[model samples]
Target: MTKQLILCDCLGSQSVDRAALSHATGLPCSRVHTALCTRAIDSAAKAISDGDVVIACAQEAPRFEELAAELERPAPLCVDIRDRAGWSEDGDSTAKMSALIAEARLAPPPVKTIDVTSDGLCLIIGPARVALPAAERLADTLAVTVLLLDGTEDLPLSRRYEVITGDLKRAQGSFGNFTLRLDRLRIVEPGGRGDFSLTAPRDGAETLCDLILDLSGTTPLFPAPHKRDGYLRADPGSATAIAEAVFEIAQMVGTFEKTLFLTLEEHLCAHSRAGQVGCTRCLDICPTGAFSPAGDSVTVDPMICAGCGACSSLCPSGAIKYDAPPVAHLIARIRTLSEAFRAAGGSAPHLLVHDEDHGAEMIALSARFGRGLPADVIPLAVPALAGFGHAEILAALASGFAGVDILPSPRSERDPITYEIALAAAMGAGDRVALLDVDTPDAMSDALYAQTSSAADSATDIAPVLLMGDRRQVARLAARTLMPQQDTPVPLPVGAPYGAVLVDGDKCTLCLSCVSLCPSGALLDNPDLPQLRFQEDACLQCGICATICPESAITLEPRFDPTDAAMSQRVLNEEEPFCCIECGAAFGVKSTVEKIVATLAGKHAMFSGNGTERLIQMCDDCRIKAQYHKDNNPMASRERPRVRTTEDYFGQRRDH
Candidate 1:
């Protein structure tokens, strides 16, 4: 890796210990005061020319970026050390700055872009007055079609596109190809409109459109209506909103680049097994209806996926990963921040994770209005709020951080952030991470300040223990490392990703229905014998096994097991195989065979005959052979009719 040059803006804003930053990064750094961005550009040019550098100023990022581009240097790592670090009252803690700089150097993985092409086949479904006008505005750019919700309203002044009356029954599909189903569709005659005479009336008419200008003044076609791509909705009651919708829809005609946020590993999913449905964790929690069950697997529509990563966080198996930055990259930031802070002669690290979009604004607001974030509280910006979970939180605690918190923007429904806090609370480290609803800068400053004050209450401080693997693997390692901190993990709340698998052994028949349906391989069945085994650590608590068990023999006990035994395989149930009476071959479950024999022997007509009852216990081959011989036995058969056929015909002719 190319070493980074840390340039602090001590001359412009506040002083940062250059020596501490150098020690933490183990790289040469140039601390410039007045001429970093302007006249005294020698240090910056020299550093950038030397290979690469880390600039500690976000305010002048554009200027530095331009300079780097002019010099043909790889994008220099630009971090907001001003609002994020220098402006803090926590004093010149260069170690935390170094940590942030280190994280910025680890470039985000290159994203694969998917092109969503739109042909501008726009549909305006709303009132005649607004829908007609909106369609007319977009007609030049888009192939517009207007559907008036109520022809009862006055007829349009003029119709540029085809004006029709219809009720929008349902709508689905993504950009460039949206499927709309309309009912009682009819064309309106524009000329001499006396009550708007309808020409052709059609039922259940369907159309394909690239964009939907929903001036309908009704419920949106998709959930999270605004988030749906290519569907621009505005109230028909508002003229301004309608104009905005029309303006926005016009520009959506050509191909656009959308990042493929979540990567789906279908084989790793526990969504279904052998036609039985198992985990629907991702489905239940996905804010957008991006995920839907596709037979044994689930499909994630990247077009609709807003990249919140709630599905990825809730997924028990690491089937879905947040590729925007990945969990590993974010988790590694926690380690870097804590380790670097301690090494740089700083104490009591209170890590604060914030979403770049929501938290950035709030951080800026707090710095401008209220007291800036406490120096002890390290701000770690992530791709999405839902990207981090219990594993990351546990890792923070294990990484010697005294406290941790996440600033969640206002949400109607609680996200995985709160759920993660609950999971860690079970481990007696709930105080380590909190979901702070910080709207104003003052609220954010106060929250971090309070957290830092309480950080001393936590007696068991942890050191950074690095572990790398999939979500489940890292979660287990973090759990095991943090287990000694608590007496026992508390029972988790509803919808928690971690829990124990419960079996109703009395109802279980060694059928292995739940075992076969388990996607995480947590439930195992021995083919050599009739038995079921469970590995708790591997279980995502997706409840797919329980949901799939036909006999209702499986149930999930939502609890945190921070012990080694949780991951160990243990036999849940076992039964002996039934041996055939004649061949001595093991075929079926002994209990099942015995139960069948008890239910049918001597009671049914077929089983009541001599030696017939024994047939039930006989192997399939033995039974077939016995039946064959019985039918072929000459002594037990009646006289043959073939020999008398000619004689019988002559005797009948004589009698007649």
Candidate 2:
């Protein structure tokens, strides 16, 4: 059943802070301000329902116009406790103070009463039941010499205060609701000067009212999905059922105004940076551009958002917190578990082994090496081959686990830079780390066997091992060879080997060793079939696929073949070439420049360094101008055809 989601927040010194409220409701502070600034246009009677109260905690006052509109239908009450001058016109003044004092005390005209000055203590509370305790604290502070004498009751009780007559006479009314009517009340002057009588409030109710009216007590609330309270229940189906359930649990709840689900335009503008107004990252990458910006806030077009959870995962500022478990919840779990795994196993030279193909090698390593060199070798297992790389690894870093051994198959389309980052992280934590290059099962098994033998013979310092290898098929081989009696293949999830390239059927041979070379989990093999799923999204298109495709079966499909724009540049030449510049000097490989220009030129326009840093050294001008012309302005030189000639090949001056 669809439940009515009520977002509630109390405006008092306790709980309900601004950040917590924003995080809980997934609404921007500005929008919340808009609601507050307009004042609660709708009445509590109109905005409340039997089953739902979506109490959105506002950073500022609610917009009166918008509140009235929200109140028209569902009667969603917008409560605005005047935090920080709802309008700002109510400044501190004496006339207003005298009027408020007269009203609250019910005293006759201009009766002078001074504070029996002791310490100017303040206590604040809200109308809610939880606020009474805070109110009582204020009474205690005011009665410095006097003590609080009351039973364990929720209601207010009478109390008396000790004061000095001389100090009380000096105190005078400063503003509305602030009065200095009593003269002999100052018990002990606050730690300041003796002459000045001005100070903050010292009464119980007045203290709370002052805090409430000034918006000082307003706090952001972070109401985690209260599963026990039934605020958030398991899905039963329609929105109606969910709403009904929520109403039953939280009576007198105020539902969200339908306008909260803003238009696509509104959502975009609100979410983007101020200067980059109308930026639509959600629209561009979101499978469904179901989000838009409203003013300075982004809102979800609930109908189109599909609750896919992608927007939440990719959002830079975490503006869009999702309710789904697939991404956000999984990400949190991965981080938590990865940390536990690392802490429990990070001592010895450890490798974080992944990939199903290396199951045999891991088993051999376990039998031969034993518990991974007597250290932690975290085997992050997953159902899908590439699923673990998305956010699990990231979470591991966040959880204080810096070192990781990436073990991928040679044939798997793994990226080295990805592993470099992991290695960097490990290095950052001062851990001995290594990316074990074992893509194929056989290679991995052999490598482990060799390592085991070497480890036994030598007294060498075995560095902390971060094994990144693919041990899928090797594990099967080990299971079959080592244990002939056993019928099942070793579970691939447990330190399975993977390769750079994998072949399903005879379309391609699983002979490529690129997977083993991959330092990161950029590429992984599918354990079920001989199939290989290239996470092209993760692949930098480094031509490692073409470099290690042993069978010549895998080719960098041209534009027409793949038809995907992201793969367009993958069609460039995979091989390098030696070219003679001006005086017959082989300046390095020509294809290297071509590759760099193709892949990174347009994308990394802002990179101050030249692409020549990786492979070869281009002439100073070529390197500098290459970035300026190609990266800085690809379209600027449309008049000149980008033609390759002898001079261009030789890195010499070309005729205009």
Q: lDDT by residue for model 1 over 387-441, one digit each (tens)?
A: 6777777778777777678777664236576776777766546556787876688
Give the TM-scores of the predictions, in the order they appear: 0.86, 0.20
- For model 1, the run of ten residues with the poorest summed lDDT: 455-464
**Best model per lDDT:** 1
Give per-residue CA lDDT, model 2, range 1-656, as digits (tens): 12222222223222233443333333332223223223432332233423333333333224423444555634333322222112112222112111111122221122122222213332121232323433333443332222112222222332332212222222112111223333222233334533323233343211211111111122311112221111123232344543443334223122221111212223312232333332244554454445555645666545333333334333322344433223333334334333333332222222254554454345434433332222222344332222233133333433333344456544332443243334233212223234566544344445543443343211112222222212211112212222223332222121111212223334344432544432222345543323344533233223445455566565432110111332222222122333433233344345545556567654664432654343233554454555556644654664676878877776664442
Clashes of 1: 4
- Native-to-model Cα distance after best TM-score fit, residue 317 in candidate 2, in Å: 0.5
